[model samples]
Target: MSEWQQRSLASLGNYENGFAFNELHWSEHGLPIIRIAQITGSQGIVDCFPGVLPESYRIDEGDLIFSWSGTLAVVRWSGGPAWLNQHLFKVVPAAGIDRSFLFHVLQASVAEMGKRTHGSTMKHIKRGELREFSVEIPGNECEQRKIAQVLDTLDTAIRETEALIDKLKAVKQGLLHNLLTRGIDPNGQLRPPQSETPQLYKESPLGWIPREWSYGSLGTWLMGKPKNGYSPQEAGEWTGVQMLGLGCLTKEGFFGAQLKLAPAGDRGLEKALLNDGDLLISRANTRDLVGVVGVYRDIGTPCTYPDLMMRLMPSEETSAEFLQLVLQSSKVRRQIQGSASGTSESMVKISSAIVTGLKVAIPKPDEQSVILCRSKALDAQLQSELQELEVLRAIKAGLMDDLLTGRVRVTPLLKSLQQTAAQTGA
Candidate 1:
């Protein structure tokens, strides 16, 4: 019948709890201490100690480790050699199971373990409960390895794709900083830095910019007094008018494709309906995200923003696209954040006075169009890459459920891969 046998996790591996290195023992540069946050995220080590601990408590790259409390996560310690701190379990295979197989099994159990965790605020997994967690593995070591190989390949791919996405985001940030400061020339090359092209750049209230680009206060570009939105009155199923929230805006730009329809005959419902080329700024939010900005690309149906946000209509002197970029740029973001006032950490707000009076560096309409077009192209690339990342994560999540749970076995797929490799001389 089935070659697989159910085994308690304790039988497959010996577990060692991490040493409780107190906060007093921390250091800047010494033996890196692996804490709970590190085990879950497990990025490069930070909190370190100068001294050494028992050899059993130490861990290095490729070691299988788990955080037993706070957050339950099984990780292969690849963040470099470090000392394992408290609330963690360093798993060492006893004899019967493959190391990678044990990690994959535990990784699959994280969700269940999280559910069963004790503590109302800070949950923890009991040692006995962790030791008793079970998984079925084929008795044959070859099959065990094949299964681990399949899961490990997906893990590797997911990690690499995540790293790539991070790099793409960093690149996009740099592109925005450079392009927004130095507008693209008609030749398509970026204008020289301020240091190199002093004549082309002139000092302004905002900063140095192309001499042709003159100072323009946000007021000059404003069509009228900034209008705050009307909040929906508990309109769960009401479908008369869609009401936009701060959530509709993202740093990547407007996700206005979806907005909750507001309650009927709401105050300011008529005036709040978003017009073409309206720039909405978050009048209130967290300190960092207080001035989050985006343009209403185009809403085909009836749409209006909520009280949490304000709409700024631009004049002929400025393009909505250009104003949107300026508002999102670091130069303007600093002003927005500095102007925001909040009583509590949970909520912060900026007044329309601060927004309308904020200074902005404006370019000739044609030059602004050039900068807008180029940034749009870069933004399109970023969005496409982001979509691919989403798909990869979804695929990985599905594979983990099926393959790890034995719903979809890898033995046959492994054999097929081996055969294809042999045929292709790979």
Candidate 2:
């Protein structure tokens, strides 16, 4: 670590708490108001809130904003002047200290400051405590500038990579919507009418589908029944059987590598044991995240689903991959939302009765194979892009931790300090 001078946060800047504006005062024409939710670390501002205030309450550019309650983060201003909400605090750096350097110091102190929080109902970092916090400061402005430049470069890279990942995800979603809704052969050349049921191509429970495709429930093709796993009292050894929880399911699919293991006796696993090709669907969660579906493709290890999940086993006629894709479609998701039962907070619960009653159009066996192959190919391409983005993110995170903490010094950029000292004969 570099030897540095220590100073309290109050000495380097003036901390100003935000003021609350009533909902009636909010207007689109006024200055943008910054909320605690808008502070997203070094990643800069986000469009989380849309409240406005007059120029009197506006905070200038380059001011560091800290979220005092709920979610905490330190954001550096990139846009024009903006106002701060009551839940946020604006720190304006004084003449001697660099604003960007102060932002990094605040970012580095997040963990320690979080520990100082006190309250049972909601966490908070008081203004007094925040102002009293101490941080190391380099004596030379040249050194501060060099350090800030290096850290800012890494932050820029992280933001760029995140933007790229978002674009790729949007592209994948658009492709899925097109391929699933309008079949690949869109020229009307491949689709042919069936002799048995010519008018069957009309509307049904799930919108328009081909006449040859048949509708059936999930339970009709299942060999074993869907069941929930037993709840354990404590965490213990694996005993060769792993217990899958909601955390093991990612937005894309099953995350088998991060599965938590539990003893066989702990899970009370008998008929609820999971097998390869079995489908797992989240039964209860937030409205948008309730019906996530994942197919278990791993074998050689036994696993069981927790109470919040439902398992599906297809019969000889149905393809597990096809069902998995169908369940993930927006049509099924909308139906699941409609069928959900609750008072204020609704949850999608796919019971044995509901699963059996649900209908799906199944393509011919050969056609199903082709669709599965095409879907898998698309998924593989997306996975590769996601992996590359993850690596870039990790690299940026590592660089931030090192450079901002002063563990890594920029010696090459210190030449300016040497020249200044030589001229001053110090």
TM-score list, all predictions: 0.89, 0.81
- lDDT for predicted candidate 2 compared with the true structure: 0.68
- State the TM-score for model 1: 0.89
**What residue pairs clash in candidate 2, if any at all?**
none
Candidate 2 residue lDDT tens string, 1-426: 446677776687777778776666566655665776555533444322355444435677777887778766788877677777787778877787788887877887777888888787778888777667887667676777778876776677667767776786787676655445443333422343334444536555666666555566656666677655554543566578777777666567777766666655542666567878778877776667676778886656877777778777777876677778777777777766666655546554556566556566666666666666667877787677678777876765675566555566656535665688699996
Off by over 4 Å in 2: 1-3, 40-56, 60-62, 186-202, 210-212, 216-225, 257-261, 264-267, 297-301, 343-348, 412-426
Candidate 1, overall lDDT?
0.81
Per-residue lDDT for 1-426 in model 1, tens only?
A: 187888877777888998888779888978788888776664757788878678888898899998878777888988777898878889998786789988887888889888789998788887788566787767777777888897788777777877877887788788878877788787878899999989888888877888888676788888987889887575778676787867887776678765786876666688788876778888888888887888886667778888888888888877777888888888888998888887885688999899988888887888888888878887787677778778877876787777666677777777887899899996
Indicate the TM-score of model 2. 0.81
**CA shift at 140, candidate 1, in angstroms?**
2.8
lDDT of 2 at 263: 58
lDDT score, residue 352, model 2? Answer: 56
